[model samples]
Target: EPEVTQTPSHQVTQMGQEVILRCVPISNHLYFYWYRQILGQKVEFLVSFYNNEISEKSEIFDDQFSVERPDGSNFTLKIRSTKLEDSAMYFCASSAGGVHEQFFGPGTRLTVL
Candidate 1:
Protein backbone atom coordinates (compact mmCIF):
# COMPACT_ATOMS: atom_id res chain seq x y z
CA GLU A 1 0.00 0.00 0.00
CA PRO A 2 1.23 3.51 -0.76
CA GLU A 3 1.68 5.96 2.06
CA VAL A 4 1.49 9.74 2.36
CA THR A 5 4.80 11.60 2.47
CA GLN A 6 5.78 15.03 3.72
CA THR A 7 8.91 17.17 3.39
CA PRO A 8 10.94 19.22 5.82
CA SER A 9 9.99 17.04 8.78
CA HIS A 10 10.91 19.96 10.97
CA GLN A 11 10.49 23.65 10.32
CA VAL A 12 11.34 26.59 12.55
CA THR A 13 10.02 29.96 11.49
CA GLN A 14 9.79 33.41 12.97
CA MET A 15 6.41 34.74 14.01
CA GLY A 16 4.48 36.61 11.31
CA GLN A 17 6.44 34.79 8.58
CA GLU A 18 5.18 32.54 5.87
CA VAL A 19 5.56 28.76 5.60
CA ILE A 20 4.56 26.20 3.07
CA LEU A 21 4.24 22.62 4.27
CA ARG A 22 4.38 20.10 1.47
CA CYS A 23 2.88 16.66 1.09
CA VAL A 24 2.44 13.94 -1.51
CA PRO A 25 -0.60 11.92 -0.58
CA ILE A 26 -1.25 8.36 -1.67
CA SER A 27 -1.48 8.57 -5.44
CA ASN A 28 -4.78 6.78 -5.82
CA HIS A 29 -6.71 8.71 -3.20
CA LEU A 30 -9.23 11.35 -4.24
CA TYR A 31 -9.74 13.20 -0.97
CA PHE A 32 -6.98 15.12 0.79
CA TYR A 33 -6.97 16.73 4.20
CA TRP A 34 -4.74 18.81 6.43
CA TYR A 35 -4.68 18.31 10.21
CA ARG A 36 -2.61 19.66 13.03
CA GLN A 37 -1.71 18.64 16.59
CA ILE A 38 -0.69 21.45 18.84
CA LEU A 39 2.00 19.81 20.90
CA GLY A 40 -0.12 18.09 23.54
CA GLN A 41 -3.53 18.72 22.04
CA LYS A 42 -5.68 16.41 19.99
CA VAL A 43 -5.37 16.34 16.23
CA GLU A 44 -7.57 19.02 14.72
CA PHE A 45 -8.86 19.18 11.18
CA LEU A 46 -7.77 22.19 9.18
CA VAL A 47 -9.04 21.68 5.70
CA SER A 48 -10.14 19.13 3.14
CA PHE A 49 -9.82 19.24 -0.62
CA TYR A 50 -11.21 17.26 -3.53
CA ASN A 51 -11.42 17.71 -7.29
CA ASN A 52 -8.92 20.57 -7.01
CA GLU A 53 -11.21 22.61 -4.81
CA ILE A 54 -11.66 23.02 -1.08
CA SER A 55 -14.46 20.83 0.20
CA GLU A 56 -14.46 21.98 3.81
CA LYS A 57 -12.42 23.94 6.28
CA SER A 58 -12.42 24.50 10.01
CA GLU A 59 -12.57 27.85 11.73
CA ILE A 60 -8.95 27.39 12.60
CA PHE A 61 -8.24 27.50 8.91
CA ASP A 62 -8.61 31.19 8.45
CA ASP A 63 -7.60 33.45 5.56
CA GLN A 64 -3.99 32.86 6.46
CA PHE A 65 -4.15 29.25 5.40
CA SER A 66 -4.51 27.95 1.87
CA VAL A 67 -4.31 24.57 0.17
CA GLU A 68 -3.31 23.79 -3.39
CA ARG A 69 -2.44 20.93 -5.66
CA PRO A 70 0.06 22.62 -7.92
CA ASP A 71 0.65 19.48 -9.98
CA GLY A 72 -0.45 15.90 -10.34
CA SER A 73 1.18 14.54 -7.20
CA ASN A 74 1.78 17.39 -4.83
CA PHE A 75 -0.55 18.89 -2.23
CA THR A 76 0.56 21.82 -0.16
CA LEU A 77 -0.58 23.96 2.77
CA LYS A 78 0.57 27.56 2.82
CA ILE A 79 0.42 29.60 5.98
CA ARG A 80 0.54 33.22 4.89
CA SER A 81 1.59 34.35 8.33
CA THR A 82 2.74 32.28 11.26
CA LYS A 83 1.90 32.97 14.87
CA LEU A 84 3.18 31.53 18.14
CA GLU A 85 -0.08 29.67 18.52
CA ASP A 86 0.40 28.18 15.09
CA SER A 87 3.21 25.89 16.20
CA ALA A 88 2.16 22.31 15.73
CA MET A 89 2.71 19.04 13.95
CA TYR A 90 0.97 19.32 10.61
CA PHE A 91 -0.18 16.09 8.99
CA CYS A 92 -1.42 15.21 5.54
CA ALA A 93 -3.97 12.51 4.96
CA SER A 94 -5.77 10.95 2.00
CA SER A 95 -8.73 8.67 1.43
CA ALA A 96 -10.14 6.91 -1.61
CA GLY A 97 -13.60 8.34 -0.88
CA GLY A 98 -16.37 8.04 1.66
CA VAL A 99 -15.97 5.41 4.38
CA HIS A 100 -12.41 4.55 3.32
CA GLU A 101 -9.55 4.86 5.76
CA GLN A 102 -7.34 7.91 5.46
CA PHE A 103 -3.62 7.22 5.27
CA PHE A 104 -1.55 9.82 7.05
CA GLY A 105 1.90 11.26 6.50
CA PRO A 106 4.58 11.31 9.14
CA GLY A 107 3.95 15.02 9.68
CA THR A 108 5.90 18.28 9.59
CA ARG A 109 6.61 19.87 12.93
CA LEU A 110 6.24 23.62 12.69
CA THR A 111 7.71 25.81 15.39
CA VAL A 112 7.00 29.51 15.39
CA LEU A 113 9.02 31.86 17.50
Candidate 2:
Protein backbone atom coordinates (compact mmCIF):
# COMPACT_ATOMS: atom_id res chain seq x y z
CA GLU A 1 0.00 0.00 0.00
CA PRO A 2 1.18 3.53 -0.72
CA GLU A 3 1.83 5.68 2.33
CA VAL A 4 3.39 9.01 3.23
CA THR A 5 6.96 8.78 4.48
CA GLN A 6 9.09 11.07 6.65
CA THR A 7 12.81 10.96 7.27
CA PRO A 8 14.61 10.92 10.64
CA SER A 9 11.58 10.05 12.76
CA HIS A 10 13.35 11.89 15.54
CA GLN A 11 15.53 14.97 15.08
CA VAL A 12 17.59 16.42 17.90
CA THR A 13 19.22 19.81 17.53
CA GLN A 14 20.46 22.90 19.30
CA MET A 15 18.37 26.04 19.65
CA GLY A 16 19.86 28.15 16.88
CA GLN A 17 20.35 25.76 13.98
CA GLU A 18 18.11 25.09 11.02
CA VAL A 19 16.06 21.96 10.40
CA ILE A 20 14.20 20.64 7.41
CA LEU A 21 11.50 18.03 7.91
CA ARG A 22 10.68 16.15 4.77
CA CYS A 23 7.66 14.22 3.54
CA VAL A 24 6.45 12.43 0.42
CA PRO A 25 2.68 12.51 0.28
CA ILE A 26 0.57 9.96 -1.56
CA SER A 27 1.09 10.12 -5.29
CA ASN A 28 -2.46 10.85 -6.44
CA HIS A 29 -3.48 13.19 -3.64
CA LEU A 30 -3.93 16.87 -4.37
CA TYR A 31 -4.10 18.65 -1.03
CA PHE A 32 -1.29 18.71 1.53
CA TYR A 33 -1.04 19.95 5.08
CA TRP A 34 1.37 20.21 7.98
CA TYR A 35 0.43 19.92 11.59
CA ARG A 36 2.33 19.93 14.87
CA GLN A 37 1.63 18.56 18.30
CA ILE A 38 3.54 19.58 21.37
CA LEU A 39 3.89 16.95 24.05
CA GLY A 40 0.55 16.42 25.72
CA GLN A 41 -1.01 19.16 23.66
CA LYS A 42 -3.71 19.14 21.00
CA VAL A 43 -2.70 18.86 17.38
CA GLU A 44 -2.56 22.25 15.72
CA PHE A 45 -2.71 23.03 12.04
CA LEU A 46 0.30 24.87 10.67
CA VAL A 47 -0.38 25.22 6.99
CA SER A 48 -2.22 23.82 4.00
CA PHE A 49 -1.13 24.10 0.40
CA TYR A 50 -2.62 23.37 -2.99
CA ASN A 51 -1.81 24.30 -6.57
CA ASN A 52 1.64 25.46 -5.42
CA GLU A 53 0.32 28.22 -3.18
CA ILE A 54 -0.61 28.37 0.45
CA SER A 55 -4.32 27.84 0.99
CA GLU A 56 -4.31 28.57 4.70
CA LYS A 57 -1.83 29.11 7.48
CA SER A 58 -2.25 29.37 11.19
CA GLU A 59 -0.88 32.12 13.41
CA ILE A 60 1.89 29.76 14.44
CA PHE A 61 3.36 29.82 10.96
CA ASP A 62 5.68 32.76 11.43
CA ASP A 63 8.58 34.25 9.51
CA GLN A 64 10.97 31.51 10.49
CA PHE A 65 9.02 28.75 8.76
CA SER A 66 8.49 27.80 5.14
CA VAL A 67 7.08 24.95 3.06
CA GLU A 68 7.95 23.75 -0.39
CA ARG A 69 7.07 21.17 -2.99
CA PRO A 70 10.52 20.87 -4.47
CA ASP A 71 9.42 18.07 -6.76
CA GLY A 72 6.37 16.08 -7.80
CA SER A 73 6.50 13.91 -4.70
CA ASN A 74 8.55 15.62 -2.05
CA PHE A 75 7.17 18.16 0.41
CA THR A 76 9.32 19.88 2.99
CA LEU A 77 9.11 22.20 5.95
CA LYS A 78 12.16 24.29 6.73
CA ILE A 79 12.75 26.15 9.92
CA ARG A 80 15.37 28.85 9.40
CA SER A 81 16.28 29.11 13.09
CA THR A 82 15.11 26.77 15.77
CA LYS A 83 13.91 27.73 19.24
CA LEU A 84 13.19 25.53 22.23
CA GLU A 85 9.49 25.99 21.73
CA ASP A 86 9.81 24.57 18.24
CA SER A 87 10.16 21.11 19.71
CA ALA A 88 7.20 19.06 18.57
CA MET A 89 6.03 16.23 16.36
CA TYR A 90 5.55 17.42 12.82
CA PHE A 91 3.08 15.44 10.77
CA CYS A 92 2.55 15.59 7.02
CA ALA A 93 -0.83 14.77 5.58
CA SER A 94 -2.57 14.59 2.24
CA SER A 95 -6.13 14.33 0.99
CA ALA A 96 -7.52 13.21 -2.32
CA GLY A 97 -9.85 16.22 -2.62
CA GLY A 98 -11.06 19.22 -0.76
CA VAL A 99 -13.17 18.21 2.26
CA HIS A 100 -11.90 14.67 1.97
CA GLU A 101 -10.26 12.69 4.73
CA GLN A 102 -6.62 13.40 5.32
CA PHE A 103 -4.14 10.59 5.63
CA PHE A 104 -1.20 11.18 7.98
CA GLY A 105 2.30 9.84 8.19
CA PRO A 106 3.94 8.50 11.31
CA GLY A 107 5.45 11.93 12.01
CA THR A 108 8.85 13.56 12.61
CA ARG A 109 9.62 14.37 16.18
CA LEU A 110 11.75 17.53 16.31
CA THR A 111 13.52 18.28 19.56
CA VAL A 112 15.33 21.56 20.04
CA LEU A 113 17.45 22.14 23.08
Candidate 3:
Protein backbone atom coordinates (compact mmCIF):
# COMPACT_ATOMS: atom_id res chain seq x y z
CA GLU A 1 0.00 0.00 0.00
CA PRO A 2 1.15 3.55 -0.67
CA GLU A 3 1.96 5.73 2.31
CA VAL A 4 2.97 9.27 3.16
CA THR A 5 6.72 9.85 2.93
CA GLN A 6 8.68 12.63 4.60
CA THR A 7 12.22 13.66 3.81
CA PRO A 8 14.98 14.23 6.34
CA SER A 9 13.20 12.41 9.11
CA HIS A 10 15.16 14.63 11.50
CA GLN A 11 16.29 18.20 11.19
CA VAL A 12 18.39 20.54 13.31
CA THR A 13 18.29 24.24 12.68
CA GLN A 14 19.10 27.53 14.32
CA MET A 15 16.33 29.34 16.16
CA GLY A 16 15.97 32.12 13.60
CA GLN A 17 16.52 30.18 10.38
CA GLU A 18 13.89 29.09 7.93
CA VAL A 19 12.94 25.44 7.52
CA ILE A 20 10.81 23.61 5.01
CA LEU A 21 9.30 20.25 5.83
CA ARG A 22 8.37 18.13 2.85
CA CYS A 23 5.88 15.32 2.52
CA VAL A 24 4.38 13.22 -0.25
CA PRO A 25 1.02 11.79 0.58
CA ILE A 26 -0.50 8.66 -0.91
CA SER A 27 -1.17 9.40 -4.57
CA ASN A 28 -4.92 8.86 -4.36
CA HIS A 29 -5.55 10.94 -1.26
CA LEU A 30 -7.28 14.34 -1.63
CA TYR A 31 -6.98 16.26 1.62
CA PHE A 32 -3.64 17.04 3.22
CA TYR A 33 -2.84 18.36 6.66
CA TRP A 34 -0.01 19.29 9.01
CA TYR A 35 -0.03 18.50 12.69
CA ARG A 36 2.56 18.79 15.41
CA GLN A 37 3.23 17.31 18.84
CA ILE A 38 5.35 18.99 21.42
CA LEU A 39 7.38 16.72 23.69
CA GLY A 40 4.72 16.24 26.33
CA GLN A 41 1.75 17.91 24.73
CA LYS A 42 -1.19 16.60 22.80
CA VAL A 43 -1.23 16.48 19.01
CA GLU A 44 -2.21 19.84 17.55
CA PHE A 45 -3.67 20.51 14.15
CA LEU A 46 -1.89 23.13 12.15
CA VAL A 47 -3.52 23.40 8.75
CA SER A 48 -5.41 21.56 6.07
CA PHE A 49 -5.29 21.95 2.32
CA TYR A 50 -7.61 20.86 -0.44
CA ASN A 51 -8.34 21.77 -4.07
CA ASN A 52 -5.07 23.64 -4.23
CA GLU A 53 -6.05 26.01 -1.44
CA ILE A 54 -6.17 26.16 2.30
CA SER A 55 -9.40 24.66 3.57
CA GLU A 56 -8.79 25.19 7.26
CA LYS A 57 -6.10 26.33 9.65
CA SER A 58 -5.53 26.52 13.36
CA GLU A 59 -4.27 29.56 15.24
CA ILE A 60 -0.82 28.01 15.16
CA PHE A 61 -0.67 28.63 11.46
CA ASP A 62 0.12 32.30 11.59
CA ASP A 63 1.77 34.81 9.26
CA GLN A 64 5.13 33.15 9.84
CA PHE A 65 3.98 29.87 8.38
CA SER A 66 2.80 28.80 4.94
CA VAL A 67 1.83 25.65 3.07
CA GLU A 68 2.10 24.87 -0.61
CA ARG A 69 1.92 22.13 -3.16
CA PRO A 70 4.64 23.05 -5.62
CA ASP A 71 3.82 19.93 -7.62
CA GLY A 72 0.90 17.57 -7.71
CA SER A 73 2.78 15.00 -5.65
CA ASN A 74 4.46 17.07 -2.98
CA PHE A 75 3.05 19.07 -0.07
CA THR A 76 5.31 21.39 1.86
CA LEU A 77 5.17 23.41 5.08
CA LYS A 78 7.49 26.37 5.46
CA ILE A 79 8.28 28.11 8.72
CA ARG A 80 9.78 31.52 8.02
CA SER A 81 11.77 31.83 11.22
CA THR A 82 12.12 29.03 13.68
CA LYS A 83 11.70 29.44 17.44
CA LEU A 84 12.63 27.26 20.38
CA GLU A 85 8.95 26.70 20.87
CA ASP A 86 8.67 25.46 17.30
CA SER A 87 10.69 22.37 18.06
CA ALA A 88 8.48 19.34 17.78
CA MET A 89 7.64 16.29 15.76
CA TYR A 90 5.66 17.48 12.76
CA PHE A 91 3.43 14.99 11.06
CA CYS A 92 2.05 15.08 7.54
CA ALA A 93 -1.28 13.42 6.90
CA SER A 94 -3.87 12.82 4.19
CA SER A 95 -7.36 11.44 3.91
CA ALA A 96 -9.52 10.28 1.06
CA GLY A 97 -12.27 12.80 1.86
CA GLY A 98 -13.36 15.20 4.51
CA VAL A 99 -12.01 14.40 8.00
CA HIS A 100 -13.18 10.83 8.21
CA GLU A 101 -9.80 9.17 8.54
CA GLN A 102 -6.25 10.26 7.99
CA PHE A 103 -3.03 8.37 7.29
CA PHE A 104 0.06 9.90 8.82
CA GLY A 105 3.71 9.92 7.87
CA PRO A 106 6.53 8.87 10.18
CA GLY A 107 6.87 12.47 11.34
CA THR A 108 9.79 14.86 11.02
CA ARG A 109 11.50 15.73 14.26
CA LEU A 110 12.62 19.35 14.19
CA THR A 111 15.04 20.73 16.74
CA VAL A 112 15.54 24.47 16.96
CA LEU A 113 18.28 25.69 19.22
Off by over 4 Å in 2: none
Could you give me the TM-score of model 1 versus the true structure?
0.97
lDDT by residue (tens digit), candidate 1, 34-64: 9999988999999999999999999999999
TM-score of each predicted structure versus truth = 0.97, 0.97, 0.97
RMSD of candidate 1 to the truth, in angstroms, is 0.8
Best-to-worst order by lDDT is: 3, 1, 2
Clashing pairs in 3: none
The true-versus-predicted C-alpha distance at residue 42 of model 3, in Å, is: 0.7
lDDT of every model, 2 decimals: 0.96, 0.95, 0.96
The TM-score that candidate 2 achieves is: 0.97
lDDT of 2 by residue, 1-113 (tens): 88999887999999999999999999999999999999999999999999998999999999999999999999999999999999999999998876769999999999999
Candidate 1, position 113, lDDT: 97
